[model samples]
Target: MIDITIEKNLKVYQGKQILKINRQFLSGSITKIYGPSGAGKTTFLKIIAGLISPEKGKIVIDDITWLNTDAGINLSPQKRMPGFVFQDYALFPNMTVLQHLEYATGDKDWINRLLLLGKLDTLTDHKPTHLSGGQQQRLAILRALAIKPKLILMDEPFSALDPEMKAELIGGLKVVFKGLGATVLIVSHNPIELEGLVDGELYIAG
Candidate 1:
C-alpha cells in the first residue's frame, strides 16, 4: 500500500492555496484523479512521484519511506523511478519511436509488444515531430510502459486520442498493467474518460 499525507502551497489567481491530501492507495490499483482547474491535481501527482517537493508530508510505500519532510528525507525521481506521462507528451524530439522505448529498456520483445499495444508498430522509425498528435500521445504512454514500472502517473494522457483509439489502448493497458502489477494514477479533466477503467477515484478540491 502507498500512504501519503502532504501539504503544498499553490499560487492561484485568488491567492495562495494549500493543497492537502491524506490518503492511502492500495497496491496494484488504478485511480482516477479529477478536480476543478487550478486545483493542483497535477502537482499532487508530481509530489507523489517526487518530481515536486511538499512543504510538509510523509509518503510510505509498502513500508518503505519515499518522502518524509519532517525528517528531511526525499528521494530523487530517478531513485523512485515512477513512469510519468506528461500532458504535453514529453517525447524526445530527436529520437525515433523505437528509440524512445529503447531508452527505457533493452527488452526487444517487450518493446515490440508496447509498440503493438499503442498501434505504432509501423511507425518505429518516425520521430515525434513526424507523428500526429494522437500518435505522439500514444507513444508517450508506450514509453512509460516500456520500463514496466510499478508506479505510473499520467496527466491527461488520452486527451489527444479519439474515443475509439482511447478505448482500445486502455484495453491493452489493462493487460499490461496487470502483468506488471502496477499502481496507476491518471489525471483527467473529463470525469467519464476513464469511467470503467479505474477502480478508485480521488477528487481534489481547489
Candidate 2:
C-alpha cells in the first residue's frame, strides 16, 4: 500500500494555495485523479514522485518510508523511479523514437514489444520534431513503460490521441499493466475516457 499525507503552500497567480492530500493507494490498482484547475493535482503527483517537497507529511510505501518530514527521510527521485507520463508529453527533441526506449533499457525484445504496442515500429527512427503530436505522446508513454516500473503515474495521457486510438491503447496498456502488476495513477479531467478502465477514483477540489 501507498500512504500519503502532505501539505504544501503553492504560489499560484491568484494567491497562496494550500495543497493538502491524504490518500491510500493499494498495490496493483488503477486510480483516476480528477479535480479543477489549480487544485495542485500536478503538484500532488510531483510530491509522490519525490520531485517536490511538502512542508509537513509522510509517504510510506509497503512499510518503506519514502518521505518523512520529521524523521528527515526523503528518498530521491532516482530511488523511487515511478513511470511518469507528463501532461505535455515531454519528449526529447533530439532522440529518435527507438533511442528513447533504448535510453531507458537495453532490452531490445521489450523495446520491440513496446514499439508494436504504440504502433511506432515504422516511426522508430523518427525524431520528436518529425512526428505528429499523437505520435510524440505515444513515444512518451512508450518510454515510460520501457523501464517497467511498478508504479505508473500519468497526467492527461490520452488528451492527444483520437477516440479510437485512445481506446485501443488503453486496452493494450491494461494488458501491460496486468503483466507487470503495476499500480497506476492517472490525472484526467475527462472521466469518460477512463470509464471502465479505472478501479478507483481520487477527486481533488481546486
Candidate 3:
C-alpha cells in the first residue's frame, strides 16, 4: 500500500496557504486524482513522485519510507521506481520511437512488443516531431513502460488525443497495467475521460 500524509505551504492569491493530503492507494490499483483547474492534483503527484518535496510529512509505498521530512529521509526520483509521464509528453525530438524505447529498456524484443500493443509498430523509425499527438503520447508511455517501473504517475496523459485515439490507448493501457500489476496514479481535470479507467478517486482541492 501507498500511504501519504503531507502538508506544505503554497502561494495562492498573493498569500500562502497549507495543502494537506492524507491518502492511501492499494498496490496494482488505479487511482485518479480528480479536480478542477488550479487544484493541487499535479502538486500532490509531484510530491509523491519525489519531483517535489513536502514541508512536513511522510510518504510510504509498500512499507518503504520514500519521504519523511521530520526524519530527514527523502528518496530521489531514480530510487523511487516510478514511471512519470508528464502532461507535455516529454520526448526527444531527434530520437526515433525505437531509439527512445531501446535506450530506456535495452531490450529489443520488449520494445517491439510494446510497439505492437500500442499500435505503433509502423512508426518505430519516426521522430516525435513527425508523429501525431496521440502517437507521441503512446511513445512516451512506451518509454515509461520500458523502464519496468513499479509505479506509474501520469499527468493529463490523454489530453492531447482525440476521442477515438483516447479510447484505444485507454484500452491498451488497461491490458498493460493488468499484465504488469503496477500501481497507477493519474491526474486529470476531466472525470468523463476517467470513466472505466480508475479503481478509486482522490479529489484534491486547490
Candidate 4:
C-alpha cells in the first residue's frame, strides 16, 4: 500500500491555506480522486508522484520511503516508480507513437501489444501533430504503460475524448492493468466517467 501524510500551502480565493492530506492507497486497485476544480487534487497526485514537494510530510509506497521531510529524505521523480499521464496528454511533437513507446522501455513486444490495444497500430509512424486529440491521448497512455510502473497516475486522462472513445480506451486500459497488476490513481471532476474505471474513491477539498 502507498501511505501518505502531507501538508502544503495552497492558494485559495481568499488567501493561502494549508492543504492537509493523509491517505493509504492499496495496490492493484484503480483509485479515483474526485473533487471540484481547485480542490488540490492535482497537487496531491503530483506530490505522490514526486513532481512536487510538500512543506511537511512523509510518503511511503509499498515498503519504500519516497519522502520524509523530518528525516531529510526525498526521492526524485525518476526514482519513484510512477508512470504519470499528464492532463494535457504531453506527447513529444517530433516523435512518432512508436518512438514514444520505445523511449519508455526497450520492450518491442509490449509496445506492439499496447499499440494493438490502444488502437494505435496504424498510427505507429505518425507524429503527435498528425493525430487527433483522442489518438494523442491514447499514445500518451501507451507510453506510460510501456514502462510497466508500480503505480499509474492519470490527471483527467479522458477529458478530451468522446464517450464512445473513452469507453473503448477504458476497456483497453482494463486489460493492460489486469495483465500488469499495476495500481492506478486518477483525478477527474466527472464521477460518472469513473463508473467502471475505479475500485474506490479518494475525495479531496480545497
Taking all chains together, each candidate's TM-score versus the true structure is 0.98, 0.98, 0.94, 0.96
Task: Encode model 2's per-residue lDDT on 47-127: one tens digit a residue.
Answer: 989999999989998888999999999999999998999888889888999999999999999999999999999998999
* Per-residue error (Å), model 2, residue 57: 1.6
lDDT of each: 0.93, 0.92, 0.86, 0.88
Better of 2 and 3 by TM-score: 2
TM-score rank, highest first? 1, 2, 4, 3
lDDT of 4 by residue, 50-91 (tens): 899999999988898999999999999999868898888879
Residue 105 error for model 1, in Å?
A: 0.9
What is the overall TM-score of model 4 with all chains considered together? 0.96
Task: Output the better candidate (1/4) by TM-score.
Answer: 1
Return the candidate ranking by lDDT, descending: 1, 2, 4, 3
Predicted structure with the largest lDDT when compared to the true one:
1
C-alpha-based local distance difference test score of model 3: 0.86
Name model 3 segments beyond 4 Å from true.
none
